[model samples]
Each structure stands twice: as C-alpha cells, then as structure tokens.
Target: MTSPRRFDDRTDAGERLGEALRDRDVDADIVLAIPRGGLPVGRAVADALGVPLDIVVASKIGAPGNPEYAIGAVAADGAVWRNERAFERGGVDEEYFQREREREAEKARQKAERYRSGRSEPDLSGKTVAVVDDGIATGSTVRACLAMLAATDAERIVLAVPVGPPETIAELREAVDDVVCLRTPSSFGGVGRFYDRFDQVSDADAMSYLKTDP
Candidate 1:
C-alpha cells in the first residue's frame, strides 16, 4: 500500500505545479490567481513562468442555515456559476439566490478592487491565461472566476492547481482549455488535509505577493 501524497505548503505546491506546466509546455501570457490563498501559489507560478501575476476575485453564496456550504458563486464583475443540484438540495429559492448573488458580487468586487490597488484589469485579449488556486474542494468560487474569464477575449484559458478531488477536477476540465493539476486524490477530504502548512492567508500578506519583488 502507498501513503497519500502531501505538499509542504502552498509555495511548495506552486513550484511543483509550475514544473508540471512547463513539462506539459503550457505557455501562459499571464497568471491570474484566486485570492486570498491563491496569491502565494500564483506568485511562485508566475515567478516560474516569468510572467506577471494578477488576481481574479469571487465570493461563494452559502446556502441558508449552512453558511459554509456553497450553492453558487459570483465573480467581481457579476458573473455567476450556480450549482443547480446543490440549490435544489439546499432548498434555495430564486429570491434567496438572487439576493445572495448581489451581496456576494459586491463582496467580490470590493476584494478585486483592494487587490488591484488602482491598477486596471489586465487585458487578456488574444492571450493565454492561466488561473491558479491553492487547491480546490467544492470549486464554487473557481467556477465563478472561470465564468468571468470565459466572458473575456482571452485566446485560451488554463486552470492550474496543486490538488483536488477527482470528481471536481473532472467537472472543471470542461470549463477551461487545459487543466494542470498536480494531484487528484480519489478519497479526498479537503484541501487543507493535503497540505502540511495550510494556514489562512491575510489580505495584507496575500496582497504582498502581487508586489514585483514579493
């Protein structure tokens, strides 16, 4: 029997993921990381690929009475990705979903503005863009972010992550041109379980990764 694989930290996972992308010949024009946890990973990946790093923000719309359970997600620009099955299971009504969507969209917009710090959104037109994240669990936010990217004029979109559950990864593949995930565990529990140091990242620390020298 083999022991399950683990990553030392987000940076470690990013380095490995970067190498994997290189090995697969993934040529990205820019790297867009989902903050606040994806910044460190995206910084490492951007450094590895010698490309600029940016952010794509999204907020999950949690189900009623289950704040941690996401029924959908909304992006900074108001793009949304809904999980119909989760909505049905959670007994989410259109009115509740619409209300949560507006609330979360504002949250995502504010977060994106804070992270950008006055910089204009990058022009992904005719560019190959890679979307990075620390890892994925339910992937609600990632889906919302991807939906926003798909609305852009990007020539190609790639999703890069360190680890995720097999089913989520498979579902995500249809949302992007390419998916470069380092590990897809069959019996995955959560993203944190695969990391040795899965500490929550603060906005300050996360934003620092966007610095040229950070």
Candidate 2:
C-alpha cells in the first residue's frame, strides 16, 4: 500500500477526493463547497460528478477573548454546532454563545450573498448533496454547515474532505450520511500541513472557481 502523505495543492487534493468518491459510486445532485478554500476542491468534485457547484457559508464563533479559538460555528440560516465540552473548558456562557451565534450567523449570510452575487441558492430539497472542503481541523465549521443541511429536506448529505485527523473524521461521520476522506494521518497537524502549496485562497480566486463550469 502507498504510504499516506501530503498533496501538491488543493486542486490535487480535490482530484484525489473526486476519484475516491467515484470509486465509491457516490451520487450527488449538487456540490456545495465551503467558501474560500473548499471552492477549488468542490469545483473538481462537481466536475467529476457532473453536477452544478454552489457555496455553503458558515462562520466560526470564536471563544470570548481568543478570536481564533472556535467555541462553535453558525451557518447562514442560523443553524449552529457548539462544542459543549469546549464551551465548558473555555468558560463560555450562554449569553456569550448566543451573541456570537447571532453575529457569526449574520456574517455567514452576508458571505453567502457575496459569493452568490444575487443568484438564488440551489434548492437542496430531496436532492443528494456533497459538501466539500479542503480539509478539517476541529470541524466546527463543517459541523455547523452539516447541521444546517440536516434540517433541510435533502435526501443525503455527504461530507468530503481531502485530509483530517483520525479523531476529527470519526466525529464528523456521525453528522452526515457519508464521509469521503482521502487521508487521516495520525500525525495530523493542520489542513495546510497536508498540502505542498497551502496558501490562503483569495476571495477572487474562490469566486472564479464558482463561475467556471466544473
């Protein structure tokens, strides 16, 4: 067996993810990618599956003082996923959680508007959907997005990522109908660590991916 390792870039990871999905005969009516990073991967996957690509927006609700530390995440439609353990550990109270959830949820809505550029969101009712991202760490954002999707009438919700820690992948499995993960390295550091050129994906670049077919 080939040893697990890093990818050349998000595109490479996307291709591998697409191939994995195909190998498993995953079906999807549409592909919804987490913006800014997931678009590249989503593009490849959507193209491979012969489906239209769309964006699913969510924002991390950081802890009270440490903005980079996520205590939870909220999707555009106000659906949320909170880490109860993290909240207790971080000493996050309900008031603060509610405040952050409201703020982040608004941000997610604005982000979705910006990405769509006034286009209506694709109807997901009764359709099989694949949610793609470059990778995951705590998976707070993906969890929030999946929670939101779960409330919808979609027939299936599949979470696809190129790499993540073993534990993170396991936790995510419970939140979706299926998960297609290419690599789950034990020595997982972060998503960028599994890519050779894991740079910040610019909004313009991400938007371009959405505009292009496949």
**The best candidate in terms of lDDT:** 1
lDDT of candidate 2 over 98-119, digit per residue (tens): 9889999999999999999889
Taking all chains together, the TM-score of candidate 1 against the true structure is: 0.96
What Cα-based lDDT does every candidate model obtain? 0.92, 0.90
TM-scores, in order shown?
0.96, 0.96
Q: What is the Cα root-mean-square deviation between model 1 and the actual structure?
A: 2.1
lDDT by residue for model 1 (1-214), tens: 1124688999998888888889889999999999999999999999999999999999999989988988999999999999899856758899999999999999999999998999999999999999999999999999999999999999999999999898999999999999998888888899999889999999999999998843
**What local lDDT score does residue 90 receive in model 2, on the 0 to 100 scale?**
52
Report the Cα lDDT for residue 53, model 1. 97
Residue 201, candidate 1: Cα error in Å is: 0.4
- Residue 76 alpha-carbon offset, candidate 2, angstroms: 0.2
